[model samples]
Target chain A: MMATKKRTVEVELSTSGIDSQGRPTRVPLVVDEQGRPVPMEPTLTLEPDMKDEHMLINIGPQHPATHGVLRLVLELDGETVVRCVPHIGYLHCGFEKIGEYRQYNQIIPWTDREDYLNSIGNNVAFALGAERLFGIEITERCKVLRVIAMELSRIISHLVWAGTTSIDIGAFTPFLWMFQERENVYNLLEGWVGARLTTTATRVGGMAADIPAGWTDGLSNFLRTFPRTLDEVDRILTRNAIWVGRTVGLGVMTAEEATNHGLSGAMIRASGVDYDVRKDFPYLDYETYDFDVPVGTAGDVYDRYLVRLEEMRQSVRILEQALARLPDGPVNIDDPRVILPPKSKAMSGIESMIHHFKLVMEGPRPPVGECYVAVESPKGEKGYYMVSDGTSKPVRWRIRPPSFVNLSAIPRMVEGHLLADVIAINASIDIVMGEIDR
Target chain B: MTNFSAAPVGSRAPRDVVPASPRDVPRLGGPQNPSADALREQFGDVVPRVDVCWGETTVLIDATRVLDVVRWLHDDEGQSYDYLVDITAVEYRDMERPIEMVWHLRSLPYRRFLRLKAEMQKDQPLVVSSIWPVYKGADWLERECWDMFGIRFEGHPDLRRILMWEDYKEGFPLRKDFPLRGRFSRSEQLSQALAANPEARYSMEELSIVDAFQDLPADVRERLAGGEQPGE
Candidate 1:
């Protein structure tokens, strides 16, 4: 049997306006011979002093190398970038506006979506900020678990950064190897929190749950094997001729310039600024933990790589200490007003059930005050500034997203450099659009 | 094991009571907190309040002299707040001046953090001098404040929307009066766009399913459109 043919429609073109001399006076309803609409040419006006060699190009909002929806408008003079303007907000989710309507404890899951890579760190930052306003100190066990989760998330984040940055610099082998380690870390985290990425593993006053069985063994096993893989990847990319040549002196920013531009984390440390919020501000009992803050002398892409590599090692050190000192007690605080009652108690006792109902129905009311808590996230200093109005919901929940601030310094870093170097510089900064546009 | 009975109910645990480790303690104090004291001493009339919370100092200065005070804080010898950590704003709907701009600054050498606050009227032309000249980091931060809160930053090199698109004509999203779902105009525009595209029949539905259906063979596509299984 023969198949039926599809119908086609044809539209006529209107070429009505013409001069009496059979010559077109003005172009009216211009169309190609095939009846396709033809667009008019755009007019261009240039000054006499303007050079013809200068050209403008847009880099993203859809380009692969932009990391996310980040767009950059580049003015190029030959192969060098004359000026670069970053246009962001393609991923804006109105996190702050949405957060204002959410209760204190309910905001944890939302915080995870902000910086999806370091969701654990973002959760801890938000919880700590809210806890400060509530004037509630978490238990030692909770603090230790938070440190472990945060350091693991840091390791995972830095691994992704190293892997992606190496890929950006034309090394694919390291990317594969680094992701292997990241997968192991994710497996370990999945065992603990049931979710790998965007893990809302923390609560306002404590962790969502105690560490699962054999989770530590998995962490230790991964930690033992991670360093060997890290060193292998390091040997592959750290001193490779192409990697070194591509990243050694590219995107150099001085310590002064870094600080003036609000750069933090490895971005500032690579510029020889000895600042780490874990050491300087010391939330979650980080003051007692023993680890060295890695400092870099040059603020180039290579220095940032070295700084981040050393930072992952430092995170391992912190993780080991936290695991060893992990206390044996309740993860949540004893306060019934803040934490939910145990299920056994809630099911059996009236007071416990009532407390659970009240805590779940109306979240803990913090005093009317404001506090800003920053954590040394892998990208930079991720902070949460919250203002309370003696209610369950916050009056203002402002996220001090480090990627948003770090991405701002791109134009300064890319100016006067080859266009190819922009990718390396952007990768070295390691910005996540989720956080930047939150 | 540490004693839990002696501790007051809901009080902080004695976590820091452990003997200090032999690690070198970095000097965290600088010139007796110079930012608050020196600014109060110098700009006494302009500086209204100095609050110390959780070991971080916040100085509330007059709205007009915010740039001058930040510049002074940046250049002063004792209080060299060379780093601009964050810039944000809070809105109070019931207050006389509803919008308050907050600046978080830090001195790297001293490891001290200082917050500077200035209030502005809620109406249009909410102008405050830009601190871009003092710290280049304020460029995007000021633009973000302008974009989200509709506060204008005077003298900003490029004071445009940082988070929202240029074509977004709806009112600021972060304002107190703005609805959480979205402004009505945005939904109207969305419906208008949907109405304008007749060929986009499956655009509002599950887009992944539409994409998969588009990839199928023509007969299969027709079968799916007719609500029939691929293999009966």
Candidate 2:
């Protein structure tokens, strides 16, 4: 018997609306040469049995779907993924190695490049860790300002995640909408720090600059209009059939597994674990800010999406509270060791000039101690572990990159899922390769 | 199966658990984490040095019993340090100082954070028990620690180079002795980069996956055979 067979399928055409002649505007029926209706059937070809064989496929170090220099070698039996081995470090510049050579304040710029999406947040986190190492408590005004910076950066990161994930799942309109809101946040950041992407806005003891005069007005404007865009994207994607069908029930990790895998931020929270670092290990006075951490029961791709969307709204609430409780005081601590003198004072007074010169040249030294300060970054728990040797430079400055840890579970998440679902699952992880390979 | 709805929320600190903000925390020692005391009681000899710095407790334990202490910390109901935050090695500036391996663990249920350290002297082989048995997240963290610091974590499955390529020969980049510039000179590094074969990107684990090597073109297969042998 032949391996292939032919079959005929019937075509049914619907009638179009009536024409000017009042007749149904229907297309002419498909007919054969013998004056009979043609059965338009496609041929089906059968091949030899090959269930035992598995195919190996490679994705990126260049592909966009893998998201920035992430190479995945996947083992597949037909369409189902049997195994996945992720190769990274294509963008690794050894930021940790470089951190050892730079001064504490000088290292803030390096933090900006590691997680480019959450650059300000990383700067804030490094400042917090370095401040702890130095035993310096920042002023109340600086605290509130850092909180605003963090939440704004969080919104920027989640917006990029939402936009990129939507595009990955074949929804284009929401990507544009999400990116528009992200641009608004970036504009606000640019107004504050004068840089859009790499806003190294934090110093060791305080901000690089206080939110410029009337800057809270821009933030107020953002807080006012951001939710409208959030709601628009939510309305489009939350119940859209295609979005739900593609995202839901993929990359399911239970609470125990998520916690054991060291997942954090939205990744662990989506697994129904309400362990927000801001709440559990409260820093920047996050406990005083009244906001609910949205927890999800399913712990799948859909839950992660919902958790992230809700987090942006919660960030808005926190930003509003931070703005309301914005204290009026000095931004930097009243210490000459970590903070520099005013530019005019440095040029005018000898004592101020000596202080500024010493600080700028030698760099403020921290006592011999180590502090691991973790903040709940948009992706996960971004931490800066610092070790001081009573010297201007750090003995070791380790960035506990959350994306690296979250991406580690890709092999576990993608195995046993279909090849198409792998893209959705990887997108759900929301990895920044710069952070992962740093 | 875990109850999906009634999953364990945050920590078991209290019904109204509120973590202290950084501003309120003392500059130096205030209160030691209770787990530090508990670890001493559980493993007296292994838990040698316990210190509190910047309000966070650091417990220095013997490198040999790291896995045991970590497993007990994870399994024990009272001191449930369920989350492994990070694994890193710190080589101090002083050449004579022993390299310290740090493990940052967090107890989500109890809202407690603890640091565990194990020092490996330069004379001894940098070997320590892996905590992968206690936490699956330790897999990549251990591999990365090995990659950067050259600390070999015993019993770790697939503890290979993570941030660097498999055949990277520049020595551990994070080690104090390693120069700021890489081991190879600039021209030599550029020449090596230019001479690298593109086909060697795939590891033996990837190439051996179900007929991949056999499927390669004969000339490519000959090239690979002439190069560094797979599984070397």
Query: Candidate 2: lDDT of A113?
Result: 98
What are the models' TM-scores? 0.82, 0.90
TM-score of chain B of each: 0.67, 0.81
Q: In model 1, where do residues sit more than 4 Å from their true spots?
A: A1-51, B1-34, B93-97, B185-187, B192-232
lDDT string, candidate 1, A92-195, tens digits: 99999988888898999999998999998888888888887787778889888889988988998998998888888788998899899899988888888899
Model 2 reproduced share of reference interface contacts = 0.54
DockQ for all models: 0.16, 0.33
For candidate 2, what's the TM-score of chain A, rounded to 2 decimals?
0.91
Clashes of each: 0, 2
User: Which residue pairs come into collision in candidate 2?
Assistant: B11-B109, B12-B109
Give lDDT tens digits, candidate 2, residues A1-438: 311222333233323345666654442333445656543322322232344877788888798888799999999898899999898999989899898999888999999999999999999999999999988889999999999999999999999999999999999998999888899989988988899999999998999888888899999998999988888888888877788888889999999999999999889888888878988888988889988788888999999998888888889999999999999989999898889989999999999999999998999999998899999999999999999989999999999999999999999988889999999999999999999999
iRMSD, all candidates: 16.0, 6.6
Candidate closest to the true structure, highest lDDT: 2
Q: Alpha-carbon error at B5 in model 1, in Å?
A: 49
